[model samples]
Structures are given as structure tokens and as C-alpha cells.
Target: MAEKIRLKVKCHACGYVMEGTSKYGKGNYHPEGLDFQFTAVGKLVDKAGNSRVKGEVTILCPNCETRNRFDI
Candidate 1:
């Protein structure tokens, strides 16, 4: 069974925090490449099958109204 995890993210620029659910990232194989959507919570897999969450996450800071990128 697949387990759902909660990803708690915080914005360094404005100290805004967001908590959401996440899952293993999956995409459709296309002629050009794999296609996926930008999700608040999902893992990214490389060609090697190694999967991991995106190291850098961009979110809109509610406090500052600025888009900030943060490292998890």
C-alpha cells in the first residue's frame, strides 16, 4: 500500500508555512519525455528510477505576496 505523507513547508522570505499532502510523483511517458504537473506535494523520479521530492519548492508567500523558493 502507498502511504500518504504530509509535507510541511515554510517560506524563508516571509516565514509563511503551508502543510499539505504528498505522494510519489508519476508521469506519462511521451515521445519527447515524461510529462507531469506541478503539484504542491509529489516526488520526482529520474531516469534511474530513483525518486525524491523536489529539493527546491516555490510557493506564494501569503504574508508578503511574494513567490519564494525554499529547499526541503
Candidate 2:
């Protein structure tokens, strides 16, 4: 099963708020955040079955339309 994570981003240049979602596993995608495109791959799993995700996401400012790089 894939886990769905919701994200909210604020534009640094114009201060626009965007909401989006990223899904883990199952190769399914639903565009939630309107201002950014994020792609995360690989997983870090613990002994207890818990996992930590690491990925790079880019934030697109609506006003300025600038792409900002971030790690999550």
C-alpha cells in the first residue's frame, strides 16, 4: 500500500500559498500542490516497520514563477 502525504507551500517571492500531495509507493500520483512539483524516491525502513522518506522537491512560486529547491 502507498501512503499519501499532504504538503502546503508558501511562495517566497509572491507569498502565494499552494497545497499538494505526494504518494509513496504503488506508482500512483495525484497532483495536490498547485505551486510545486516534488519527486521522492527510495525509503529508509526501521526494524519496527517504520520508514523515513527522503526526496527533493521544487517549489514554484505563482507570482514570480520561480522554482525553489528543497529537501524533505
Candidate 3:
């Protein structure tokens, strides 16, 4: 099977780099509308040597070119 990928989505029309729920490095999933499912999260560290997860998110926009990320 192919490996999964993670990336920060770039809104083409608004140029928005979503911050929260986007503090990710890499992850995996099978997106056949939940026929299969899996997810993994990386570590996050702050300037103070602290860490906290921002969690996963799903965002949709109707007026722009926003699309679901593919694990390629």
C-alpha cells in the first residue's frame, strides 16, 4: 500500500494558512468515506520546550477551490 502524507492546505482564493488543528507533520488514512480509517499525530514543541497537540480538522469552503487532501 502507498504511504500517507500530511500538509498544510493553502486556500487559493483567500490565501489562508490555517493555523490551529494544523500543527501537524505527517499522518495516514484511507479515505473511501470511512470504509477504512486511520490517523497518526506527530509531536509539537513550543519555544519554552513545551508541547501540545492541536488535533485533526476537516475544513470545507464552497466559494473557492478548497478540496480534500489525498494520501498519495
Candidate 4:
């Protein structure tokens, strides 16, 4: 059985809160609360021709439509 972890994030612009759950090994992560969207920004290419996304992410807040950026 995999472990379940609780996740929470706060909006820096409006003080809104969001919650979610993720499985340790299953990689089934889902967020619940105000409607929001996230996009992975920036990319890095390795010498092996493999591309990996950066840890930085841009989140659009549904409450105020403010775009918040953070490094995860």
C-alpha cells in the first residue's frame, strides 16, 4: 500500500487556501478547493537530449485571477 499525503497551498494575493492529496508512490495527485490552473514554466535540456521541466510553476488564482509563481 502506498502512503497518502495531504497538501495545502495558500494564495499570496488574496489569502485564499487550497487543499489536496497525493499518493506516495502512485503519483495520483489532485487538488481541491477554489478553481485554479497551473502551468509548468521553463525547461532544461540535458546532454543526453532529454528535457526536464523546472521546479518553477505559475498558478492562476480563481478568486482574484491573479497569477502567482512559486518554486516547488
Candidate 5:
């Protein structure tokens, strides 16, 4: 069975919830902040426990902190 996960990012300016799909990517990403692009690849394992290039990652965001929040 495949596991489930979720990522929650809050806006610094307005605390707007920035939710995204959490596809399993190894290690910590954006530790230094969201001022750059992040790429990572991990080893894959089959049902029989074999090894392969798992996948890669790309974080796409608006990076617009100024307008991330809205008033009700």
C-alpha cells in the first residue's frame, strides 16, 4: 500500500494557507528559503525490493509574499 502525506506552507505576510501535493522526496528542501530552485533525486524500490532512480523534484511557487494574503 502507498502512504499518504501533505505539506502546509503559511504565508509570512498574511498567514494564508499554502497547501500542496506531497510526493515523497528525500531530504530537506528550501532549508535556505524560497529564493531559488530545488532539484533532488532518490533511489527507487520495487515490490521485490529492487533499486532504480526514484524521481526528481521541482518546487513551483509564485514567490509573491506581498500579496499572499487577503482580507475578509
Candidate 6:
């Protein structure tokens, strides 16, 4: 199996950390303090069968309700 892409984000406001993974053009973040998912727009995978999704995602922090921007 191909290795999953690991995602980690830290909130500058409350210092809360978010973690997730990207595989097959789908992104899934832990729902502990956040609930979110995104699908890659065009191509699902690259020539190597890896996720080809690349973009910016904005999410509100669950702890302080601060808006955080992330690049995936």
C-alpha cells in the first residue's frame, strides 16, 4: 500500500493542534475537535497513484472558534 500523506496543523490562536490524512484524493481530519472533509477537484491521483489534491482549506478552531488557514 502507498504511504498516506500526514497532515498536521497548529492553531496560532489557542495553540490547538489538528491532525489528518490524505489518500485517494480525499482528506479526513480527526473529529475530536473538528469535523471536516474535502474531495480533490480534478484528478484523484498522480502518476504514482498518490493523492493529487493541493489547495488551501480554512477551518474554524473548535477550542477558540478562530479561523485557521491550512495548505494541503
Per-prediction TM-score to the true structure, in the order listed? 0.43, 0.65, 0.29, 0.42, 0.29, 0.51
lDDT leaderboard ranking: 2, 6, 4, 1, 5, 3
lDDT digits (tens) for residues 46-68 of candidate 2: 99999866667787766787776
Report the poorest 10 consecutive residues by lDDT, candidate 4.
Answer: 22-31
Candidate 1 lDDT tens digits, 1-72 = 233434466767767676554444344211212121233355678999966655444556667776765555
Q: What is candidate 6's lDDT per residue for 1-72, written digit by digit as tens?
A: 323445678888999987766543234433333444443344456788765545555667778988887666
The lowest-lDDT stretch of 10 consecutive residues in candidate 3 is 18-27
Q: CA lDDT of 16 in candidate 1? A: 69
| Root mean square deviation (Cα) for candidate 4 | 7.1
- After superposing candidate 3 on the true structure, give the runs of residues whose Cα lies further than 4 Å from its correct spot: 1-10, 13-40, 54-57, 68-72
Compare candidates 1 and 4 on TM-score and give the better one. Answer: 1
- Ten consecutive residues with minimal summed lDDT in candidate 5? 29-38
Q: Which rank order by TM-score, best down to worst?
A: 2, 6, 1, 4, 5, 3
Residues 1-72 of candidate 3: C-alpha lDDT, one tens digit per residue: 333324445555576653222222334343432222224444467999966433343544344646434221
lDDT of each: 0.50, 0.69, 0.41, 0.54, 0.41, 0.59
Q: In candidate 2, residue 30 scores what lDDT?
A: 57
Distance from true location, Cα of 67 in model 1, Å: 1.0
Cand. 4 TM to true fold: 0.42
lDDT of 5: 0.41
Identify the leading candidate in terms of TM-score: 2
Residue 33's lDDT in candidate 3: 24
Runs in model 2 lying further than 4 Å from the true structure: 33-35
Report the C-alpha lDDT of model 5 over 1-72, residue by residue, as the tens digit: 222233445666555555554323345433333332333445557899965434333333454435332121
RMSD of candidate 5 to true structure, Å: 11.1
